[model samples]
Target: MEPTQWTLTETFQFPAEYGKAVSAQEVKVTAGYTEHQTEDAVRLSGIYHVAANVGFDGEGKEATLDSDAILIDDVDVQDQSGYFEYAVPLLVDLPTSADGQLTATVIDASATATDDGSLAVMWTVEAKLANVEAVAQNVEGELTKTALATDETAKESKQEVAQVTEETTTAAVTPDLESSQVETVTGYVDDNEMLAFINDLEDDVTVTSFRLNDVFVE
Candidate 1:
C-alpha cells in the first residue's frame, strides 16, 4: 500500500521562571515520540526539546535555555458514516483496527520571546503512515486430528479388554482346571518404529519404559 503523508504543527509557550527575554535567537528543536493504533485512529505521544539563546532584563548577557514540551496527537480515519476508512490497506486488512506503522520527521521550527517573561515555540512535522498485509500460519489442525484418533483407539481397546475380562470371570469352574499354568512371553520391537511413534507424541509427554508381553521395553 502507498504511504499516507501528513503535516503536524504545534505551538506552546515556555514557563515564567525563564524570565522575559529581550531577544531569543538561534532556536533549535528536536523531537522523540512513539505511535500506536487505537480503534480507528493512530495515537502519538512524545516530547519536544526546545533550546535557544535568550537576552533578558535589557542586558547584553545571553544564556542558553532548554525546555521539554509534551506533544500528543491523533489521526482519525473515521468517515462521515462512522466507519473507519483508509486510502492504503491495513496490516490486518481490517477496518476499526489499529495495525500499521507511523513515522514523523521534524521539518521546521521557530522561537520568540513573549512580553510575559516566557518564550514561545512553534514547530512543524512531516509524518508518513502505512500498513502491510498481515502474515498468518495454521499448524494445529493435523496434530489435533492425530491426537483425537489416538485417544479414540485407546478407548476402544480398553473397552474390549474390559468386556473380555468380565466374560472370563463369569465362566463356570471345571475339575480339569485343577492344574493351571502361567506363561511368560517376550516380543521384539522395531527401533525405528518405536522412535517414530515416540517422536509423534506431544512434547510434554515423557516415555521412560513400557511392558510388552511381560518384557520391559525402553
Candidate 2:
C-alpha cells in the first residue's frame, strides 16, 4: 500500500550500513540519522513543532514497516522547517548489531494558523539504514607515494666489488599529531570538550547520555 501522507521518493539507509553482530547488552547500537525538510510555503504557513520517530519498522521490512525508535532531535533555525534529525538507539538484548534504514517521517504536525483549509504539510523525509562506515571513515588522514632510486649495478663486475654507491631512499609521512607536543589523547574527549563544542552553537543545546532503568517518567 502506498502512503498517501508522504510518498517515498527515494529509499536509502541512514548511514548506509548495518551491523552483523550484537553488543554486550544483547542489543545492537545501529547508529544513524535523517533529515526531514518541509517544503511548500502553503503547507508550512503556520506550522510549529513536529513530532518525530527514529525507530524501526517490522522485521525484514523497511523502516516504514514496523520499527521502534532511538530518539527525535530538533533542528535549528527551522521555524517553518519540517526538517528534523534523529538517531536510533538499539537497547534490545541480542547477539551482534544491526543496520537498518534511517527512516524519518512527519507523524504529527500541528497547524498554528488561525484558520486552516486542508491542513496540509509538504515535507521531504529522507531515511537511511545498514550504514557501515569504516573505523576510519570519519577519520582524517593523508597519504603520499614514495619512490626509491638505485644506481644501475655494474653489469660486468665479475669480482666482488664493494663499490661505494649512494642509494636514494624515499619516505612519505606527516603529523597526525596535535602539534602541541603535549600528552596525546588516546580516546574520545570528555564531556567537557563536548560541552565546549556545544557552547559554540548559535542556539541552546543540551547533550545527555541516559542509562536504562536509571530514568523514570511519570
Candidate 3:
C-alpha cells in the first residue's frame, strides 16, 4: 500500500505591541486533508480553541494561559494518541513543569489594529508528516491458518476410492502418505515466524516480538 502524506497548518491572531509578546485566547483552529483542497473526498477536519488571561503592560498586553485544546475531527485528542495516531505538542520555547504543564514564555508578537481600535497579534504553526501509512483494512480477533506443501512422492501417488465409513476408516494408507504430511508440517520449521509487531508512532519506535504457541499433528 502506498503511504499518504499529510500536513497540518494553523493560523490565528492575538493582541500585542510592536516589540512585546502577545498571548492569544480562543484562537480558532481548523485542519483538513490537503487532498480535499483540490479533490472530491470525505475530507478530514480538526478543531481547536486557545484561551488565556490577558494583562496589559505599558502599551503592550501579556496573557496568562488558561486552556488550549486540539480535537481530531470527531475524536477527542488524548495526551497519548493510542494505536493508530500520533500527536506531538510543542509550546515553542515555553517552560513546562514536572507534570507537563506549560508555565510561561513571552512570545515575540506583532499586532494589527481592528476597526474597533484593537490590536490583534498573529501566529502560525505547521507540521509535515512523512510516510504516514494507513492500513487499508483492519484484521481483528485471532486468525489460525495452515499451509500445505505436498512432497513429490505424495503428488505422484494415485488415490483409490474410499470405502463408505460408519467407523471412519480410509481404504489405504501408506508410509508415503504419512511422510508427505510430515514434510508439510516441517516446512514451517526453518522459516521465520512472527507473532506480533508493535509500532509506537507517538514515540517513533517499533518493536517486534515472537512466540511459539503450538506445533502438533493430530
Candidate 4:
C-alpha cells in the first residue's frame, strides 16, 4: 500500500510555571499517539513531549524544562470504504483471519515561540496500512523428455536413467498495488483562552525557542 501523508500545525501555550523563556536551545520533541476510527474519520489522540534548555532572563543562565502537550486531530476517510478495518482494526470488528497493520512516521517538524509566550508546532506525517492474505491454488504441470545418443566405441549397450521432481509452494501473499493521498489540517488554540489560562498559573513563564526531537505513530 502507498502511504497517506498529512500536515498539522498547532499553537498552544505551555503551563506558565516554566517562566518566560528569553531563548531556547537544544530543544527536543517526541510524540506518541493512538488512533480510533469514527464513521467518517479517524481520530488521533496523544501527547507530545517537549524538552529544551530555556533561558528565562537576559542573563546567560539556562535551565532544562521537559513538558508534555496534548495532541488531537481527525483525518477524514469517508471516501475510503473498508479503510477503517484495515487501518484501525482495534476500533472496528473484523474476522480473526483479517490481517493488517498501521504505521506512521513524522517526516518534518518545526517549532516557534510566539511573542505572547505560546508555542506553535508544525509537522508532517506519512501513514501506511498493509494487509496480508493467504491464497491456495491447484497447479498442474506435465514434463516430457526425448533424448537420443550414440557412442559406438565407448559403451556396449549401456543406458542410465535418472528421475528428479521439484515443487513450489506459497503460504501468504500481499497484493502488488499502491494508493496515495495527502491531507492538510490546521489547529489553533485561542489566544484569549490561552491568556486566561496562563494568567491563572502561579508563575509567569513562557517558551522562547523550540527544537524538535522525534515524532512517531502507532
> Which candidate number has the best TM-score?
1
Model 3 scores a C-alpha lDDT of 0.30
Per-candidate TM equals 0.34, 0.16, 0.19, 0.32
1 or 4, which is superior by TM-score?
1
CA RMSD, predictions in order? 26.5, 42.1, 33.8, 51.2
Runs off by more than 4 Å, candidate 2 = 1-118, 140-218
Give the per-residue lDDT digits (tens) of candidate 3, residues 1-218. 12233333322223333212223222332222222221322233333222222222224344332234222222222221111122233322211212211112222223332333222434343432222232212221112111122443354452322324422453453246787888977776534233222222445554534454553546
lDDT of 2 by residue, 123-218 (tens): 333222323464245332221111111122333342234232212121124443565333345233565697688789776554666888899978
lDDT of 2 at 216: 100
Worst 10 residues of 1 by lDDT: 80-89
Off by over 4 Å in 1: 1-19, 58-100, 130-218
lDDT of 1 by residue, 49-132 (tens): 555554445332333433542211111211211111112111221132333565655678676655544445556666554423
Alpha-carbon lDDT of model 2:
0.28
Q: How many clashes in each structure? A: 1, 36, 2, 5
Go through the candidates in order and give each one's C-alpha lDDT.
0.49, 0.28, 0.30, 0.41
Better of 1 and 2 by lDDT: 1
lDDT tens readout by residue for model 4, 1-218 = 45677666555333344333343333444555676665554555565454433333323232333344332122112212101000111122112232245555567766565565444566676666543332112111111111122343224333221111111112124332332111111113355667678678676465344555443545
* Clash count in backbone of candidate 3: 2
